[model samples]
Structures are given as C-alpha cells and as structure tokens.
Target: MKDLLGFGLRGRLREGYTAADFRADALAGLVVGIVALPLSMALATAVDAPPQHGIYT
Candidate 1:
C-alpha cells in the first residue's frame, strides 16, 4: 500500500507528530544506521577517503 511505504508520513504530519511516531522513527533510524554504516565506511575506503568522512556524509 502507498501508506506502507510513502504517503503515510505526510498525512500523519498534517495531523500531528506524536511521541509514539518519534520513538518508532528513532528506532527505525538506529537500525538502518547500524546496517548501513559499515557499508558506507567501506565505500569511503574504496574511494580513498578516510572512513570517518562516510559518517559525516
């Protein structure tokens, strides 16, 4: 459904941003960062940049 992937957030914000939404989004972001950080660091290394720059990016 469109709501599952995209438009739900805009609609929700139009209504209100509640505490539950903040907690859920924060948890999702934490999980995504844990999974993506290493891959990004590797990408930075392949590009000959320092690893920390990947986080800055």
Candidate 2:
C-alpha cells in the first residue's frame, strides 16, 4: 500500500523541507482545492449525482 501511494514524508524531511516549503505547499494546495471543489461538483452533476458526493469523493 505504501509503495502504491509514494507520498513519503520521511524522504521529504530528509531532503530538507523548510518553513518556506511548507508555506508554499500549503498555498498551492489551497488553490488547487478551491478549483477542484467546483470541478468535482460539476463532475457529480454530470453523472446525475448529488453535489455532495464530490466532497465525499
């Protein structure tokens, strides 16, 4: 399972993830989430499902 999803924090820490990196990553994630929320809802709507399913998904 770990191999399948290779989001390794230990490796990132070893590679020196600093405060600036955290800030940048956080901002980037926020932007992506903002865009994805409506896109996900649109996808659910396209399939005739409730918009909330996008959040669960």
Candidate 3:
C-alpha cells in the first residue's frame, strides 16, 4: 500500500527528539535486551552449548 511504502520517509527520530523520547527508546531497548538475553541463553543450553555461543548465533 502507499502508506506502507512511504512509512520509512516519516522518521520519528528525525522529526525532533525530546529527552523523553530518548529515555523511552533507551528503556525499551534495555527491556528487550534483558528478555532476549535469557531466552537466547536458554536456547543455547537446550542445544547443549554455552550461553556465549548464542550471541554468536
């Protein structure tokens, strides 16, 4: 669709970032990283490999 195709041109970050926006984005990234780290480690353990090996994957 036209909207989907043009979505990338609408940059939320480029529009003008306030301190709140930066804090929000950083917090979201941290949460995702926290959740993903254990999941990745569990996956690697399931395969009988070290947790660090998941990072390489």
Per lDDT, the best of the predicted structures is 2
> What does candidate 1's lDDT look like per residue over 1-57, in tens digits?
467648687787879898898999999999999989998898899999999888777
Error of 1 at 55 (Å): 1.4
Off by over 4 Å in 1: 1-23
Question: Would you give me the overall lDDT of model 2?
Answer: 0.89
* lDDT per residue as tens, model 2, 1-57: 473437887778779999999999999999999999999999998999999998788
Residue pairs clashing in model 2 are none
Can you give the lDDT of residue 34 in candidate 1?
95
Q: What is the lDDT of candidate 1?
A: 0.88
Lowest lDDT 10-residue stretch of candidate 1:
1-10
Q: Which 10-residue window in model 2 sums to the lowest lDDT?
A: 1-10
TM-score between candidate 2 and the true structure: 0.66
Q: Tens digits of per-residue lDDT for model 3 on 9-41?
A: 446546877789889989999999999988998
Better of 1 and 3 by lDDT: 1
